[model samples]
Target: MTAHVVQRSTAETTLMRQFETEKLSSSPRRADAFGRFIAGGLPTRRVESWHYTDLRAAMRDAAPLAPAPDSGAIEDARAILTDRKRMAAWRIVLVDGRLVAELCDQFPPAVSFSREEPSPVDVDDPMVALNEAMSVEAYVLKVADGARVEGLIEITHISTAKDARSVYSRVAILLGIGASASLIESYLGAGPGVQRNSLAILTLAEGARAKHVVLVEDDAELHIESRLGQLAAGAELNDFVLISGGALTRRQLFHKLIGPEAKITLGGLTLLDGKRRSDTTLQVVHAAEAGTSREYYRAIVDDEAVGTFQGKVIVENAAQKTDGAMKSQAVLLSPRAQMNAKPELEILADDVVCGHGATVGSLDPEQLFYMMTRSLDRDEAESMLLEAFGEEAIRRIEDDVLAEALRRPFWAWLARERVARVGGEGEIHWVESAS
Candidate 1:
């Protein structure tokens, strides 16, 4: 018998060595996950799910794994979080992907926290498997049964190192039966080549309710955030995400309904400028009877930026009377801007209502002109229109202050730059030339 050995890339070799040095290879779970990753390799454009992002090509060389932030980096994070401190009662901080116990507030009686390894899923995705293999520690958060918490629980992730690096973080949240809470996940950092991978697993017991919000702030680069969740009978989730900056950002979500009368509402808003690229992909499964799901996503792209949204809803034969709908809309602010939307519905059930729709277009000239005629300057009108468009989705958020905070970065960009800069198409002119 002959044995064949596959070759590994420079980054893969470095990571394998790091894994051994860190003694991660000693764990059977991590070893198995790494094996799966080695077999699948990195996802490329050939894979339909990754056709647009092309992560394998985006990352030509693997970066060194980010380590625990030093004292200097901790202070940097504290300064960066000054404004956000008011947004939540308790904040969980992760610097360079390592948890900072001193910065995190004491948990309430309804909540408990622990650290352990994340459970590997059945999927054969390289990113997922890599996260499992690379993750050094995972946070476990549990809510007491029937406990209703009023304040917000915020998880803040910051990367302060200047060198090219990568970090993996894992989080698991369990909502006990009839428990309720508000959770926020915020990602913020600055670097040209820093890469981050995060995996989150959420489980909602019967009658549990949760509102999950994700905020991707400015200066982030090469970020991948994936979420997987299961909902039990009468479970309800109001989930939302707002992305304002990143060189390359990908948000992937998968949600499954395991019991009857499960309801979920999903919304997303992305703002891209310069040459940034952002992709939001999601799938919802209706495996039980009387499940309901709704998804609405919107994006604004400027300059040479690119934005994409891919959403899918599947209704199984056993999921009778299931209701699902998804819609994606984008507005291009420059001629060179690009937006791609793919929304799909799959139904193997006879009695179900499901539909999906997508739209991509430029700002309405007529609407802008009308606003100008009403005494508003062209730039002011444009800003107002953009804010109004974004506010639609923000209005649906469960937290009023959080929604307002999410809008600041978008407006800040508009205020700082020339809104009428010449670009691929629909270029705005600041002054009329004497002809």
Candidate 2:
């Protein structure tokens, strides 16, 4: 009998060594997760879900684990946080994957936070297992039952690693029955060679409502974020993600409607420039009757950048009268830019309505010419069209404040795009006016 040995990459080998030294690996759950990751290794193009990204090939080697945040690093993070544009929200700070108490703002009576140990999840992905094994701690936020929070609860993750390193963080948000809240998860800073893995879990009880916004604008070389959500009967959730930074990024979303009459809206906007690559993959399951979902995504690819979107809507056998629609669109600004989109629908119930569509094309030359004739320069006209293209997804947000806050980053990215189009010589700046 011949035995076949699985070949491990340098990054996998490094991860094994790091796991051995970590204190968290002593727990049985963590040990089991590490074993699972070792067995499967990193996902490759051969994996249907990861076919477009090829994470195993991209991660040639892994960096050392980031150290605990020291006083100097905390001060630097504080300065950065202070300089950023202020929004009306309650802030929680995490530096180098560790929560900083002094930097956080006081929460209202309806909201509470605590530190908890990472628990086992039902997800089958290797990356999720790795996060479970390597995460130092999990931050848990709970909204009291029937409480209506006034402002957003923002979790700001600041990476201050000046050298090549890896960081892992976990967050869980639970909303009680009849509770309503808004959340913002922002990723900022990190050296050019840093690698980060972040996980967020959301659970909503019956009659709960939530709005979630994720902003990825860090300088990490490799960034991967996984979001898991479960909704109960009569619950509603709206999730939006904006990707405009990082050299290589993959965002994964898994959501399930576990109870009848649940609703969900998933939207994303990706801005790809230079040689950056961004991939957004998602799966939504309608497991109960009369559930509703809408998935809309858009991307702008320029230079030699590449963008990928893969989404699937599943209607289970018991999910009668389920309604779902998914659409993905992209505009390529350069001849070398690339956009790949794959949308799928699986229906087991006869009374379900499910469909998906994808489209990729370049900007309209006639529109550009028309805008130019109206005294607008080429860059200005292009920016206007691109803004309108991306705004469609943003417009789905119901909250005016949250929608405007998310728009600031989009406007900033467009300003930078304009600068790159003309010449990459000047310092790009964008200021929000006091309207």
Candidate 3:
């Protein structure tokens, strides 16, 4: 008795022939999340949490799904959302992945917006069951109960496909009980053979509070984002992610502090250069008792880029006095850059107090020779010590205008890394700053 087959690539056989010519795959929860993504197919490097971004060897094929926007792609996504500038105060657009109701904006009266249908996710992740089986529709966004909504609530996911395509999106964010909110999840225009699959679901409830900011500037040639969170009793959440575009990226976060004393603060920043590759994976679960968590991440790899940070902190057994902390830092600016950090901790009660840490080096050659002996050069002292090491994870955002709108794209990706190091090394260019 031998039988071991499972080979399937070509982007998992074009995602199983686009999930059998989708019509939301005849429902039943998108045919049981496309039969659990055809029994686990695209997540490689032997899937130990996708071992530093393998994604079926960087998705070898699959790009032809995005369609549904024309009226000249919604007037070119309404002229790029009316020439940008309005970082938030309620704005909700989404183009290639649907939800573009007259280009969105007008939510108050305790906030509300709907679209429904793609929920049910218990997460055994096969890219969240292939984005709940090729997405189709799910844009929720609710607030209500004890609402205090003030400024930010962005939610812009553009991607106006200009060539090879594939995009699937789903979003759901709800906060009720003693609700408070602030959120921005912007992933802009597609370029360079686009392919994106994104999913976001967050629920808060009891004494709810949330502040989330994620901006992955799209240069998609394969980008995957999955975030799921649930917090309840005394809920609070603060999450921040800023990855400067993709050429192959992976960002996944799963959080759950299900009840008593729930709190979380997770931060991230990854900005890699050419030959790009970025990955940030995190998981936190304190299931109950005195729960609290904090995870911070930072990375800045350069030419021949690659960056990854994997973090996990779990404390079950009735989460006794659980409190956790995790940190990851990286800097490598060349010599064929690369950074991989793994931080983990799993404690089963016994009055928990978890911890984790990781660091990868380079940049700080005696603080760049004391700022090049005080008159800086060498690319302005390595872009002022990599913008103070990516502004220490955007100063753990306690809203200084959302930490300067995530520091104007971390100072425009350090002014495009000093105009790609004074326009040399493989002649890179792109100098558009000022946010």
Best by lDDT: 2
The TM-score that candidate 1 achieves is: 0.92
TM-score sort, best first: 2, 1, 3
Best by TM-score: 2
Error of 3 at 265 (Å): 12
Q: Residue 176 in model 2: shift from native, Å?
A: 0.7
Each model's lDDT: 0.82, 0.88, 0.84
Clashing pairs in 1: 335-424, 335-425
TM-score of 2: 0.96
Q: Tell me each candidate's TM-score.
A: 0.92, 0.96, 0.33
lDDT of 1 by residue, 206-302 (tens): 9999998888874656889888889999999989998886799999888899899999999989988889999998889899999999999999899
